[model samples]
Target: MKTLEHIPLNGELPSPKGVALAILELCRKDDATIAEVARIAQTDPALASRLIRQANSAAHGGGRPVASVTEAIMRLGMGTVRNLALGFSLVDQYQNGPCGQFDYQGFWSHSLLMGLAMQKFSNMTGAGASEELFACGLLAQVGRLSLATVYPVEYGRLLDGQDGVARNLVALEQEHLQTDHNELTAALLGEWGIPGALIEPIYHHEEPEHSGFSTGSRPYQLVHLFYLARRVADLGLAGENERNACTAELLLLGGRIGLDAEQLGATVDDLVQQWRTWGELLRVPASALPSFAHMSAAHAMRDEKSDGAAALRVLLVDDDPTTRCMMEGVLSGALGHAVVCANNGREALALAVETQPQIVVTDWMMPGMDGLDLARALRATEWGQTMYLIMLTGHENEDEVSEAFEAGVDDFLVKPVNVRTLRARLRAARHYVQLLEAWERDRAQLKQFAAELAISNRRLAHAAMTDLLTNLPNRRSGMNALAKAWAASSRFEQPLSVMMLDIDHFKRINDSHGHAVGDTVLRDVAQAIQQSARKDDSMCRMGGEEFLVICPNTDLKAAVQAAERLRRMVERLRIQAGETEIQTSVSIGVATREVGMTETDALVNAADRALYRAKQAGRNRSCVVVQGQMRCFP
Candidate 1:
């Protein structure tokens, strides 16, 4: 109910520190280079070794084994390297924290299962990238850790009372902490620079049906994947009864997600195998998981559906015992239906609710409460409205048939019922039932398709606003974010700052070392500048060796100092452009919003002017506009 902002995370939300922090910071830049990431990774031998190992891991087998951090970076890409570093770093940091209520080893073990499940599910469904999914799944429940870290004593009490049956942990958390794990999980992921695409699903994964995400949407599918993964983990870790229930639910959920029983079973097997492998690698305990193929086969034997199916329940009502016995024999033996018999219409009406039959066959002339009266009574209720009704009569009278039709009888059987005709009527009823089921299935598929399409459209739109090279927000996205910040600053009367930066002598580097080397330099420069940025800054690639940083609640002096810091960081970058060691510097211009500044574009233009002054005053310097006057910092 309460927002994550209200919950205090003690400024320590299980984030990757040291080299992992540097790696993540570099990876967030749209123009981050592979060489740059490798360089930073190599700084920490443990992180370097882990990256190489991950690149050569069975899960990422494509080429020859990687022997160096650069090779690993090239093979794994920046995103994968970043996530691995983050995951390994967190494992190193939080192995034994102050959270007494949290099962630290169990947490990692379950997280490993979930992560492996998500990766396998992604590979099978082609839902998203498998590498990122592993991290998403692993950190999906990090909010639980956040709560424990923030409120140890209170959360420990909450965990003590967490029977898992009497009180759901999330509900108990909301009652006491005013926020649940999902909320904190989303917030922490966002803070860690994970994408909104992944964060939103985790946020709503707790109760996805009511999450407002459409049933077939990408986020919706992701939520279901997490849910299925959680269930699979439970099945693996739970006792006999829980495992059986989880297996059934897993199969049903898989079907909804477009996986057949065989595919679903195979996926479960693969997931368990991966879980075992990852458990060993991460040093988490992994128990033997229940085999889906074996469990599913056993369940199939116990709850098999025959050709005629056990779903059909037939009610046979007649005053004559001989007729009732004969009808029951025909329906149960020949039609393969579970038959419930009643002596008269009064008894049939009571049995209808008790047995909830799909078909009802009754004698027209009864001692009390005739077939017509029973049919009318059944039709008046909701459940009986769909039940098929038939009347057995001694003679065929046109007026009687009309009256029976009005009373909701579907067909009439005259005299000694012709077995062939009765079979034909039952086949027709079966066809109708099949059509109803088909309609429902078609409707569900349609909803899923629409949701998928909507999700696809949103992703496409996001791509358009993103820079392909640096993976940072493009100029358009930057402008949009600045506009939003401008509105917020205006409302709250807070200072907003903008810095425009340009890599010095970029054109000369392109001309000297060819465009390919220049491109690498540009990427390295972008990453260096991004790494030096603060948490609240919005960094953007403003076309060709030019970058913009938007800082909210920052003053003129602080903005200048940040710009100067970025210039020095960029100045120190010793990029390897092929065999040549290429050094570069940046000229930065900083501007802050004053009382009269109204438009974001004007603010950006002011920063651009200051940037030009920095360039004019010689490169590798920061210039700030203080009271409409340019002040240069060397």
Candidate 2:
């Protein structure tokens, strides 16, 4: 897991901005009042409205609707309102950014469901404060969003592998980005000053049972509830088999908390209805789900089809032919998978590497090499890292079980295995294999998308810096290059010169022959200027009728010669526009940075003043500024 320092402090995650920043500053004061929070909330009317609506949502227990920010803060408490404002503010600001892999709409939808589920589950189980739990559920997955924001392109690839064999998202994140969402979420919640009561449960929600807290403790129970809420959110968004799997998981979770199947089913139906209303208020997507009992019934209708095509290659190994044949018959018949049988562990390892099977089921006590040895060997290889390995053992010793797992066995089956148990385990393995294949396909597609996005970004950057009319650097780009040249000159004690040139009496061409003629003259003059400029000079269009030339490492005399050359070329230039033969001349001004000038802008202003002097002296000549005095050059 990554530490707080691993997270980029440079606006990578959703920290408070605008009104949210103001509210947070006020929150830092221990004596801040409801009116103060309300005042800050009202500064962003849209965020203020969201806070009021959230305070009255069913997740918070629907009651008399509040009419003002002050009323909402009084009802929801200052802390809850502050957090809500922060959440809404981030939602508004980052709904669309560089995270192409992140589904902004789906994120909010899932969070809203989790929030509603947390509140409902806590109310039924009496696990934690409903209001606080609601906030916890809403922000539970925010760290994932933060990761996407910080590393948009890389995170998109990580999210693509989310459904692969690695079921633990945190583990996958740690492997790839050297950080996990759990640590990030906990760190952010702590920074926000949320009570540990809420933060600890969210930190461990991913593996609630393994969290150090005692099973019946408040933190443990809350963790379990949060996990259940995540499943509910998954069920709410899932379709087909995914929905059934989540329903099965939710049923088991509800049982642990002493809620019977029927009670949990009805409660979820009510929650879904309320979630729809809240989703509209939050402007997030929410689909209506049938009662949990109904979804469970759908699971029954689909169970046979679920095993239709596991599609994964299975490698089955056993020392005895009879046991090997029996296992092969069941797995191939049930899953309709292609099965390869090996009588010994050594042969199994060779076939596994050759065929690259998605799953391997081997007996624990094979001759020469045991299942543990085979599993360990396979895990040491690249392809074997993702392969699902299951050990079949009659030994019920706890130490042996731990050793098998440490050897990379995904699951273990007692020998004389019940056919029903074996079939169920195979089905689970099939699900994992399918997910891995899907992830591989998604990774290919996302890689292509990233390549295309990179190209588009480059085109956009080029367009931003180049002027469309003449295909030259625009004023902004020119100014940036000038600053760099100035810095280089200052460092080397060399002079840098600038020339500002404008077409003399150019408006007459536009007014007499139309602006189309004026455009033609401008294009022609720009081309002539480029043809005359030295290789080291930078040319830019300073918008209609004016241009700038930057000459680095050149003193005032050389700059004056370059300006006169450009002036003579413009006078000799001729442009034909719609039967009108146009002749144009330019007035030039030259300025060079000397001892007393400390800024690039000062040099540019001096050049403009010289250009004004040239225009005053005559419309088609060059003027150079020397020692703060303008001298005309014929």
The candidate maximizing lDDT is 2
Q: Write the residue-wise lDDT of candidate 1 on 1-634 in tens digits.
A: 2345777555456678899999888888999999898888888887787677667765563668879999988887778778878877876677666768778888878877887787777766778977778778888888887787778888899999888741298889889887778878887787777788988887776677767775467988898887877777777677765566777888888987788888888888877887787677667788775578888776655553443434667889999999888888888887677889999999999999998888898999998899999999999999888888989999999999999999999988886987888888877766665666678799998999899788878877888998878788899999999998899898898999999999899999999999988888878877876798888889889999899999999988888888888888888889887789998898999999976776887899899999999999987899988778998997
Candidates' lDDT values, in order? 0.82, 0.84
Q: Write the per-residue lDDT of candidate 2 for residues 119-236, one digit (tens) a residue.
A: 8889778887677678789888888888888878888888887873324777888888777778888888878877878888898887776786653568878998999998888888
- In candidate 1, stretches whose alpha carbon ends up further than 4 angstroms from where it belongs are 1-6, 10-13, 17-50, 57-67, 163-168, 214-221, 300-634
Enumerate residue pairs that collide in model 1.
Answer: 30-470, 30-471, 30-472, 31-470
- For all predictions, the C-alpha RMSD in Å is 15.6, 18.5
Q: Give the TM-score of candidate 2.
A: 0.48
